[model samples]
Target: MIEKYEDLNESYVTAGAGKDSTSIFYWGGYGTDQTGITNYDKVDGSDIRGYLKPESGSYNGTPNLSANITAWTNGALSDWNGKANSNVLKGVTTGDGPYTSYATIGHVLNTFLASADAKGYDDWYIPSCAQLALIFMNLTSVNNALSAIGGQQLSPSKAYWVSSEFDSNNGHRVYFKDGSVNGSSKGSRYSVRFIRDI
Candidate 1:
């Protein structure tokens, strides 16, 4: 019995896994236009981000971390979230992705996305670096929906956080401006785009 949530601006398909199975959707937040905005939507506290994971294997068949890092920074990386997550895929489900509960916005993002009643689904999880890259590729469609709903647009050249953690202190941040995935401190402020399983 998955909970169903809808609102004047509920963006379900965008948040859920894509029909391509290789892509993921970007759920829009309450923005200036109010597209897909839901009352259940909540952003994390200011300056409250944290690490996503300590270590990850590789993206798809490319075990070379350097190559994978180079891919996203150039353009959006498109790999099936399920098919390509050979290295970063973890079993952490709703209420279980974070090392702790409600300690930071990063944890909250994982927990909420897992249990969130978006389009009557509740199997969301934090996306690995590769998965995030797919979302980056689909940002145009995503941003359009957000703009229609008066939501914020993801800046083209800004660093957006991915769930890939390089170490205890750092997680991956994808540069939407370029497509480069770089490791940064978890506490550093950046935009979050949480992708769930289809």
Candidate 2:
């Protein structure tokens, strides 16, 4: 798991994603900048689990970290801020599908976490590969917590992307179908699942 900022390396040249070319958040200067790279990692006491709401209801207060969560999948909404229709991928009811073709895999997951309003909190962000692994390791507990929502898979039918890459041509992905992990091409359209840190 991305245990700390150092996991990103002193000067990470982003792993190749695909021919499309996507932006990655990095903390270094280009060759002639003359200044050392700046650290971009930030840590605060804010926890995402605090905002995860238990169910849909009249949400009128700030997030409560200690609030009991009833389900995780219930956060899906239609037309986030009315900018589009169907907020969650699985819940999309409009044209094409839940997402437009332009939506990058990373962006979809990030949006899910960022738009979370559970228990009145909205501080969720996408989980890294390591984080997803942690949840996988605690499969029993995680599954139990998410069981209230039927769609969560203890075993995914296909491999899912993690926003982490191994090289210019390879990226890491996890398969819930049988709890297997592997790497594949970035251009390949694979399933994606988003997670947030507790």
Candidate 3:
């Protein structure tokens, strides 16, 4: 039977299709708000911070190696203040986004990555611009599969950070709105989403 996950933050499916059978991926709230100051709800006592891909099946699309680059960077603006800007935070829709400072954003990112210690794996990454694109490309297929299983769709409009650094800059971010990359200031507060190998 299809599976579903319900939490204080959001609800989504936990499975998908594989090369020859069906698979499911449950949403792990890696990078959850711990302090409760960000106006976002905390689902579990331990902030969830990473995604866990279920076993692959026949419907699961094959992985693409070409877009999986290790290093990418987004450009920065002079106005960066290490705080999340309203335009980037997806969880909160008001006040230039959800962070009070850049440090908070970093804490959130680190929290998610660190809380994942219980999972016993450490290849988790913030994802590069190209990698984010791969997600966008596969979003439809994934979405379709999720729909069949009663999963919700996740579409965040903010620019998310990736481990990839830009050739011209020290950091990079992927603007999901247009599938573009930029060299951003490390101090600037942007959104973060984690990825791990299945």
Top candidate when judged by TM-score against the true structure: 1
lDDT of 3 by residue, 1-198 (tens): 111211111111111112111111111112333122222111111221112122232222222112322211222211122223211322332112332222322333333334433144444444434455455546557556757877544343556554433222124454545444444544444555445556
- Overall lDDT per candidate, in order of appearance: 0.38, 0.32, 0.34
Model 2 CA lDDT for position 74: 20
Best by lDDT: 1
Candidate 2 clash figure, as a count? 10
Clashes of each: 17, 10, 48
| Candidate 1 lDDT trough over 10 residues, lowest sum | 37-46
TM-score to native of every candidate shown: 0.43, 0.41, 0.41
TM-score of 3: 0.41
Model 2 per-residue lDDT tens digits across residues 122-168:
43333434444444445555666556553344443555554443333
After TM-score superposition, the amount by which residue 35's alpha carbon in candidate 2 deviates from its true location, in angstroms, is 16
Question: So what's the TM-score on candidate 1?
Answer: 0.43
**lDDT (10s digit) by residue, model 1, range 93-182:** 211223221123233333344443344444544455556655565667767776777656666756665544444344456666655555
Off by over 4 Å in 2: 1-102, 113-122, 149-151
Clashes of 3: 48
Task: List ranges where model 1 is wrong by over 4 Å.
Answer: 1-105, 110-120, 145-152
